[model samples]
Target: MQPENVRQASYRGVEDPQRLYLAMLQDGEHDAREWLSTQLRRTASMADDLPDDPAQLESWAANHAAQVATDHTRYLTRRHQGAPRHYFANRAHALWFLQQVAPTKVVDGAWLHGVLRHWRDFRFHGLIRTFLEELGDGDPRCNHVLIYQRLLSRLGCDQGLPLDPSRYLQGVVQLALGRHAEHFLPEVIGYNLGYEQPPLHLLITTHELAELGIDAHYFQLHVTIDNAACGHARRALQSLRLLMPGQCAKAFYDRVRQGYRLNDLGIDTPSMIVSFDLEDELLAALQRKRPYGQFMHSDRCRLQGRTINQWLADAEAMPGFLRALEAQQWVRRGEAPSHSRFWTLIDGPQAAMFGVFTAYEKQLLHDWIVGDTAAEDCRRVRPGQWERDLALEQDAPVAQGEVCVDRMIERMWGNRHATPNGLRATRDFIHATGLTRAGPN
Candidate 1:
């Protein structure tokens, strides 16, 4: 069989092979089943598949790398402890194992990670150094792995940025040095995954740093923001020791010095510290959709400092505005099914951030609220919507039609907007009241 076929077939065996193995151990004896339970309990910890140390992770990568082509049987045998090594000599043996029962099931992703880690550990010590000898210039696998590894190392490094060390040290000094193992990294770095967007590099500049007035409290937090774009960084985290700030609190400021920061976290510095403003660019984009100041109701914009809670709490006309704005643009001039009505909303400090929608759509939404045009186009597609439709029986219901937010979020990034969390809460509350069933997402 081809390699791909063998791999697929092996996976089926991997998922289910419990009964046959127990039978083999039992030899059809009644006592064997009881003995198997005890053995099973002993091996329960193996299910965790934790690395013995940093070296073990590397060894795992190397082992899998070697198995990529040669000795498929040995590869399968090595997966289980106490299982005879090299028991399977050919693809047929692997197939037999799959058909037979096994004591435990192997998780697919975890197994893959173990193999990849073995290869990486081998490469780290120059065992397979040829792949990454030149850095940024090598075979595809070598280059990809090397670059990612480098990026992770850079992100993890602590260079001692200009944070106050005294406060950070306070957290460590408070810890009991004798009884507790100190975990310094978690105290310094924070990991969060936002939607799949590129790093906000422009916002990282020191100029922006000046605008975020850094107080002592901020330093004490030792906040490190991780975007998770780099795989090596994620992998290296296997060795990370997590501890309270009471231990090694200084490590937090050290990370700050090394430029450990988050892209999404806003700066607290004074606004005057920023040399350039994005206001012009934002204004230009807004002008393209509507005449400047068309949406301006009063000199004082209602959106400033408003949380997402407040925005969604506005009159029922708000959702209408969203629906209208979403419909103005057609993918092609005259396509059948159009775009989504709910744009992604982001909550910024002063503004409710939403994305590219047309002026006509925005106006139509305002009109829908107070009786300009009855929204007749909204339709329900998923079962959730059907459930939601039924709930709104007391209120007048529209036809079974509305747009899905998935398409908007996935395709054009149309769903992103700057709505405050509070505003989002209010919107969610209102939405919950309607017939729509909550989505699985």
Candidate 2:
């Protein structure tokens, strides 16, 4: 089926990755294939750094691991020398990075879905296990997508920008890889190899996010699970070596190289982290709210000699209006938000304007008012303080009018994985695939 809103809703551009994601899920053979040829061509110029021989993959991974360890040690030394965060300038910046990357994280491990049905093949077990882990084996807490969803919810970053095409590249490539794997198994293997290797940035990001009181379990989870010693990194290499065809090996290796380089197609993490502009983000947030807010406020209150509605009338007035709020003490910049009269008006339920802003808008306003203290001046939680394992409360009460899932069984359905009948079918599939013979992925 299509994603939540593909046919009815229009996204940023005609080639939005979200559409391609569901399109690939729904029908990858024809439509998705037609689009991929143009996109995959761009990966042509990328360097083929992987070894030409499959047998050397483990050795290559070991060397890469050693180099990463050395680089991270150097990074730690610099940090201990009274340096600021290498990735984030502040908590707001960190939050922005998370939001920008949410499109990919929400569809975690989608590239392996195509490999799941190949569980009968022992070589496919590794990839299958990775996919299952991404699903947390049906446990809500461990599921990568669920964890990322919870992280965004906790930070009020659920309403993120989905307009950017770059935001959807990795995610689209992944979901499209169903037999987007069977069609290009070598490329999928190559992509997995590149993705599983833990980077120095992941380690530093995990450390810094915790220092900002952000629950970094999502990044932390990657750090631990992608470990070079015995984790997905090793698994990726092992799987590749075993699965690579013996004859026509050179053509397969060529495809694998192309797949490895595909990981480099989108904006890298470091570049995105350094790109945050607090004022620009704030201005954009205000601009989006301008239309709805333009006529909503009354003339009862005045700021800078104009009524609140008058202050918000012009798009150009947004910046000056912010200045007016600060000048009139409506917003106390660089201080605890509670100390400002404006903060109370939109924060608590008792406040007059609590529902005016969405969670994302409120976060932007909150961070802007709090200013520089959004990161440093805030109290830091010790690492692991907020890293508790989450358990799904199946018996939890649902209040009236709340959204709930009610499954409709269809005997002819395909992979409705969460329902009782679906789960039973999955178990039967697993049994049919001979999991015991395949062993641990």
**What lDDT score belongs to each candidate, Candidate 1 first?**
0.24, 0.68
Per-structure clash totals for the candidates: 56, 0
TM per candidate: 0.17, 0.83
Report the alpha-carbon TM-score of model 1 versus the true structure. Answer: 0.17
Per-residue CA lDDT of candidate 2, range 1-441, in tens? 011112112123337676666555455443555445445566676555577677787788888888778988998899899877788776677878888887778767766767764656888888777666556554555656767777888778877763466677777777655445678788788888888888777888888888777888888889888887878888887787788788988888888877776677666777667778887887888888888887888788899789878767887888898899889999998888899999899888999998887766676777787776544644565433432555443432222221211111111022234334433333344334444324488
Model 1 scores worst on lDDT over the 10 consecutive residues at 102-111
Off by over 4 Å in 2: 1-14, 22-30, 373-441
The model with the greatest lDDT is: 2
In the order shown, the candidates' Cα RMSDs to the true structure are: 29.4, 7.6
In angstroms, the error of model 2 at 207 is 1.4
lDDT per residue, candidate 1, 1-441, as tens digits?
Answer: 012111111112111223332332233121222322232233232222223342353454344334432443344455445443222222212212221211111110110111111222322221111111211111212122222222223222112112222212111111111011122222122211111111222122211212222111111111121112223223223323222134655554333212112211122121212211222222233334344334434435333344323434444334433333334431111122222222222212332444334322332222222231232222222211211222211232223222322221111110111112212322232233231222597
